[model samples]
Target: MNKKAKIAVTRKLPATVETQLEELSDAKFNLDDTPYSEPQLIRAVSWADILIPTVTDQVNAKVINAAGPNLKLIANFGVGVNHIDLEAAEAKGIQVSNTPDVLTEDTADLAMGSFIMASRRFGECERMVRAGAWTG
Candidate 1:
């Protein structure tokens, strides 16, 4: 059998996504269930052909530089790339891509719900209930 393309995932994802990737390539997920430190991230990027990263993870210039010649693409799972060093990736001729439009409505709905809850004193109501304020 031909060797599969090696990819590294920096965070835990749903099983469906894992299965999808596994069908096409060999994926290495973070086994410790913890975030990777800078040095660990650098080493993983150095060995990975593709990197799947989350927004909370920092992919700075140092990490980008250490990706070496094997790194071809970074397929970010989130909609934002603020945590990644775009200039450094460009300098190294590495391609960076992201999954956009997937969380737009979900994020917007969460923001709206949070705003309403904050405006309506929902926390105060919960506190009242917990404080035995029911008089009916």
Candidate 2:
């Protein structure tokens, strides 16, 4: 922790987030915003102390096994950790972290939309509510 941790980000982050990460660590960003192939991902994992990968970036056992001793953490930039190989990471003494509940709002929005579209019978209720005509 005394020295700058080498961080490899597998995908592009927001400008502000990237800047902050760079300030904190020796961050290597995916400037082109291109998804890494499995081989490329292995190389990245083999080269850094920390890895920041998106949900779509599958960090499986093979990739984990190929990681170098310097690779200590995999900080997934998404809600689910299923994409990462937890068992492999544990065996390697590497910690895995993720952004939990990051898609709560999006999930709720999708659920509500699905509910509303479940039946067209609620169309009048929807219009009435929008028009401030619904008392209940």
* Predicted model with the maximum TM-score: 1
lDDT of 1 by residue, 1-136 (tens): 8878889998998899999988989899997767778988898898899999988789999999999698989889989999999999999988999989989899999999999999998888888889999564
Model 1 error, position 135 (Å)? 2.9
Worst 10 residues of 1 by lDDT: 31-40
Model 1 scores what on Cα lDDT? 0.90
Model 1 alpha-carbon drift over 4 Å, by segment: 115-120
Residues 10-121, candidate 2, lDDT per residue (tens digit)? 9988789999998999999887788887998899998899999998788999999999999999999988999899999999999999989889999999899888776665
Off by over 4 Å in 2: 113-136
Q: What global local distance difference test value does model 2 have?
A: 0.91
Candidate 1 versus the native: TM-score?
A: 0.86
